[model samples]
Target: MEPKININNSTHFSWLSCWPQWTGYAAALWSLLYGLLGLYWFLGGNGFPFGKNDSRAEMMGSFLSNLNVDVGGPVIAIAGLVGTVVAIAMKMTWGSRFHRAIFLSYAWIMSVTLIFIVPDSRIVQNFAYLFLLHFDLLDWRVINQVFCIVGGFIWGASAIAYFRLTQNACGNCGRNDATEGSSAKATAKWGKWFTYFAVIMALPYGIVRWAWALGIPLGTNDSSMVGNEDNVRVEAILGGLCIGGGVLTLGLIQRWGVIFPWWCFFLAGKQIPIWFVMVPAMLMSTIITITGLKLSPQIIFMMVNGSITNENWGQFVPFLFWLPWGISLGIAILAYYLKRRGRCKHCGKL
Candidate 1:
């Protein structure tokens, strides 16, 4: 039997409709939580959502250390405040043309800020996962993580819902631009440039990693150049994947992006679902952004006061690329989103 296409099912994703305004509710609730956390941080409270410093906190501190502690606290608090407002907007503006735009904007903020805090919280409770634990306990950490996972899922859900709603209302482009002044041509043009930039930025990181894997020690002192026996193999593989993702980004602009390439065995030539591309791309982009933010402080510290050695600088090569990579990837994702939302190519009537 052939796998099905998501035409009729687009508008009425059972999960999305099952709970109307769930996204709104979820966004609002998390907003309040972030507000509280922000207050705590602003007040110099040692505590974060789940617990205190661990690897993730250390990671953030690695960045945080560069700034005056006095400034950092307020910065964090403000991030929370921003999240709160965005979340409220997400819920309050359900039917407006701005709904998805708000969602996307908030998503970018959360991708960096939320992912930053959640990782710290998650690392503390992550061990619970090893025991096959349900983690149903009513502690702040568990509650926070639960909400976080739900929030992440909601981001994807909102994207899907927005696409469906658009497809159903405007069968063609005529009605779309009427409501929102954004044009398909403009969105596509920006998307193409962004994808090119993303691909360009990702190349250096991948190459740097691959170089390390080859035992070339592209950017590190011998003492710091520790690697597992198979480190070379693993790093090489990772580098390839990085380059691969970059190349695949071209699909965002090319026709093959909308319809699967003929080479895709089972999915060949099918009209690709927007969510299929956007959600994962968004997820990866978030992760990349998080990784960069987590490590940026450490990198900065070394350059400023830690160490200025050539080898030490070399180690930072891959991480350095993450800056541009993250920004480019985010833009590319937004572009693809605009393209698809502007005019969905496939959706059967319910």
Candidate 2:
């Protein structure tokens, strides 16, 4: 049964709902700006263009050399593209639980890939050795892995629940038997495609991790690096699997939004708290998309010209400026839409 959303209920537009949107917007803006600034610093020669001869590149190269793999530029670009597409899709399809579910699942897959592929040891060691000399949080690996895993699960489950609620036919909306609609059919097809894509994407990392976990020597990497890599891969694989399974189940039953999977525990079969789901999802999406859009060009230019050095860092300031402005404007637009949607056409509550 599809749950009847009180779209016209003014009370539903309470500050609580608005706050998450605002918070997400703000965080996204700041993160995007900072990331751009960071990239500018990297490329303009003032900081370190990742592939150039700067301190940052040297550090990264050394780290990668130790890991026996080249740092992947295309993979990073692909992740950015996926993140941007999903974010924009979410914004355009705001009230549709089905679209939101698909977007959320995509975002989770990207996040998991980032965690696994980025090499946490490199990030942690770089920050500690190059940026923060006095920090000593090495033993917090377990805690960090736990947080990432939990976050991935939350995102995957949220996607499932939202999709389930939207497809439900027995609810107050009386929109059941709606599967014959083209939109419904298209969405179902997309769900299947996404499930297969996520599983395929996750397989490489999953195989390596599983082998490593069972005391099999898959490679000669350091124990810490191996463990971190395995954890990240497993998190991504599990998250993808959960989302794929949940969506498939929902599609089979024609249930769109009502949560039925007891696996979600506290949040199972419940209307997701917008704050917990929408807020973080929006923020993360905006940050990654905006940052990528702003920085990729500059990074490419620097890479081509081989001029990423300290002298060019000033050029990055523009990226910082554009990112915050863009993200803030995006948030404002979303807020306006939410406000407009608050006015119920059926009941005129707002």
Candidate 3:
């Protein structure tokens, strides 16, 4: 018998029905629990999760450090209560156009605030530390941020599923035969451009790190600092990862993204599962964006305070592009998703 290759891998996720309210309910529960935690803090609870009042204020970014816990506690409590109500409403699956618009807006706002506003670059750095097996640097603040981030992703996913259900589309694929047309083709036309832009954005960071590793000191006059063993090792790692990530990013528009290349003996010519590419791309884009956002304020402050001078400009400047790099990568991933998503077998939607 010939070896069987699963080319129809895209249809397997069709089991995910659009009508399920479990995710929405889960979001509501998360909001409720977090709200109660805020209520505790508002009532003079000893463990306020973040800000200067927190014992880990130094590890918290400047933006977080400046936050007044008293004000934040009440605000968070109110937001959580409101989010809980909105999340529950989303599960109802029926509303007027105006009401739907308002609910959708609220859901996205909640997602963005929790994911982007509540956390900073330290969360990404903390994960890198985990990869390095440096568990000592992991702290409660990182855990709290990760929790908030998870809630944000849950809310966002719930909102999307709700939207698809209300629109009479496949919950798993966000499509119907009627809605299918040239959208994927259009995405393909533009996707490559965004991929290129993302690669370009990553280049400066990679180049700087590689140069540092080679003792070129591209951004500064300090030759001695550039050649240090620790500096070289760290820069090499960062540079290699940056370059490798860029290479992987090209697969979004490359042929190999869909099918295994000839280079792999047994896997060659086999269909690559959609989720294999999507899950990692989604995660990478999110992590990159969060890290960039977290670093922006601090980087700007450094530039303003003259803390970043010609003596060490190379170390700090290339990172300034990270925000755009992550954003472009995210856009590229969206394009790839749009291009690759197939007909939903369960709903029979294309």
Candidate 4:
């Protein structure tokens, strides 16, 4: 006879009951470590992430690049200490509405600043470079930015868990029995529109890029943009990514998002894991938003100075929509999550 196994008695199942508390602890630990790193930088330990030490620093282009170590370092250290305190407080189940509001706002502000503001285009560019097997862009700057992004994610998760707990909702599913039917349904309703909008935003860039790759000047008179084989390869790769990502965005609202599509061969008809789709979509959305914001200052300056002429306007124009594309995609992802995250096993909420 086969051995009987009691999965409920397994150690892996133990953490679920107290996951919110654990997440808060993790956020606190991250804040403390980051604070210490800031203190080290303030004390003139080498490798501060901003200003003169950052090789990619361009005045007026990056916010961090303008922050001198003497000022930014101590500020960072102080902020981290405060963040640690906030994380610890959030872990507990105490506080009035006003106090909770302040802490939650701080948590979200830190999350947004770390994930979206601290990172520049280099992080996204590194992904492209990595595709070409180039290792030069994989430097300490990228690593530091990635570290900040991880901290952002930890804090965001902790804040969300805290929110659910405070509201007396199911922590696993974020649904209050008293207010269950309205929010999720409404979000899912609006999600379809956001998905369509996201798809539309990507089309122009993808089409123009593909046109350029094929030696056709869709917006410019010059075909020299793709005259060389290397340039053509780069254009093609970027075009493919834009188009492919747009297609994948549609999956968020489609049947295939929940069940494997026929294209999956043996995996077809299988129920898709939510994280498999959610993780990539959320990460890509964040990257797109960061890239758009990072490039805005320089790009806008170029436009103002008439540096971007008719011959090159096409390449730069479509990217200006990246910020909106990212935001819409993010909303769509949230909607999809609300729609699909049904029947939480831990909380037994439907």
Candidate 5:
């Protein structure tokens, strides 16, 4: 049968199609929840309705403290709204291409902003203080729950759509007819290998996180020695694991193969799909690696000043892990899938 092509005027590649339905669904949900939470923060309101840290006044005060009322305030609010709306719109069948562009733009801008803000010692300290002071004044728990649920729903819906779009036997890039030879075999072979690579890279990290959460003390150290010695160790180990794993995975993707382990036969000169799988994997891994590297110093400072103690450091932890990790992971998976669909069936090349 001839391959198919996606002719929906969607210039942007559908990278999320590589993984199972659940991956896209989960990612979409995470993006939406994070986007909405960011929106709430920008709007000078607490998204969490019932948590101790869910105070509008405190959130607003924090915003004002870090951002100038005239420039920063308006920019944040407008950006937040636009970003949230665009993210939601991307799930729709008609405007997904445009919406995806907008969503990516927003994410990039916010990521840059976070990079600048997180490094500033003064900003980190003040933000932490503000959050602690107003912790109990707002209703954050409910708001957070709502965001989670809504975000999950969006993710689920978008994931379904993405899956349907990719599963079409039609090839991407409108290359329905092509030569048949070694290329076909190569394409099929590489596709499976790439999928395996992604799974292998992601599995260990997930396992480590799960073990850490379960109090396994699996050699995790705290990059920011904020509280008890034990807590510091735990955080450092986990943080280090994430940062290190991401870096190693990225390096492997870049190198394509290595020559150390005797058990591995394809360790020397395996030319994987560089454009599709390798590039996207590297991009995703870079996000996490860079964020971890950048945030290390700031987290250390916070720990030293007692601004973020063991008991209260949980608040910042999510931001530290989720932002870069989630974004990168989503992009990586999406890119892989898109590349898979776009590959030349006969040549096995993208």
Candidate 6:
């Protein structure tokens, strides 16, 4: 009951149908990278990760501090080697439950762990500034995380796709079954919910930000920060844009989101590229949200408990939207991939 895919990257390859077949290889590659890094860490060196693996910011360093480097290095290397093997084994047509779990574990751990490596200056700038303004700086701190996210997304999404495709017997594409249509409908339904939740999560954050720009002190402990007068116009502009953009994000599940309106002129009615929507949504929202959470403990304490503290209540404003924004967008991205599973532009298949 596998649906037929009508797309090809070359005479020998039909990527649309063959994409999932490569997830295992991708997972193995990531595992190998981790293994090598582990080996490097074992060498009493600091660059286990590209930049800023210092004691303060390094992930899980505090807990692992007591473990001698001599021992830790070997342990890490062993795990990497085992992971590489396990990851490689799953490259088969159907991955086991254990392998699926492994994929999810590494995907989450590896990708999220990279967020901790972001610098202090980047942390203080706030999420919006980092995402909107400082985005152009081509630093490896950002690059590493991007790789982490991409690797995780690929392994995880591909595994799910493989399961769904095989489960539906979609591998037997010759037989016409209700699987494709039913699965698409289900995926789309989830997509709608994801988009709806994403809108709700983002709407409040944008509204509060907009309010801040208008000098309507939302939570800043310092009134003068609002009185800067310079921010009044600047923040207002940013707020308006955030409001508009948040609304536009809902278009991910809407008709206009998929096909541009007539006003778009030449691009109107054409299917928008998935990466156009997904790349920004995933990277920007993720980094912003993590920046909100992954920074220093003092800041985190204030954000979470600021609402209760008599002083500096405004510190809590960022928290109100940060988590929801991250979760909402993450789920929304999943829904997007689910709905558009087989519709690859390069392969020209749907």
- Each model's TM-score, in the order given? 0.62, 0.31, 0.87, 0.90, 0.31, 0.68
What value of lDDT does candidate 2 attain over all alpha carbons? 0.38
Compared with the true structure, model 5 gives a TM-score of: 0.31
lDDT per residue (tens digit) for residues 144-205 in model 5: 33343344334444444443343342332323234322243444445444434543444444
TM-score of 1: 0.62
RMSD of each: 9.1, 16.5, 6.3, 5.7, 12.7, 5.9
For candidate 6, write residues 30-50 as lDDT tens digits.
Answer: 767866766887876675533
Task: List where candidate 3 sits over 4 angstroms from the true fold.
Answer: 1-21, 54-62, 221-225, 263-265, 301-307
Best by lDDT: 4
lDDT (tens digit, per residue) of candidate 2 on 166-283: 4543111212344322233334444444434433332443344454444444533445534465454543443343234333323222332223356778767874332343344344
1 or 5, greater by TM-score = 1
In terms of lDDT, the poorest run of 10 residues in model 5 is 118-127
* lDDT, candidate 1, at 27: 58
Better of 1 and 5 by lDDT: 1
lDDT of each residue in 1-350, candidate 4, tens digit only: 21111112335555744566577888889889988888999998888988888867673245688788899888889889999999988876447777888989988998988998888888777876766677886888889889999989888888888777777776666766676655667787799999999888777778888888898887676657755567788778877888889999999999998999998999999999888999899999888888878787778888999988888888777778777888899999999988887766655556
- All models: lDDT? 0.58, 0.38, 0.78, 0.80, 0.42, 0.56
Cα deviation of 187 in candidate 1 (Å)?
1.8
* Top-TM-score candidate index: 4
Greater lDDT among 4 and 6 belongs to 4
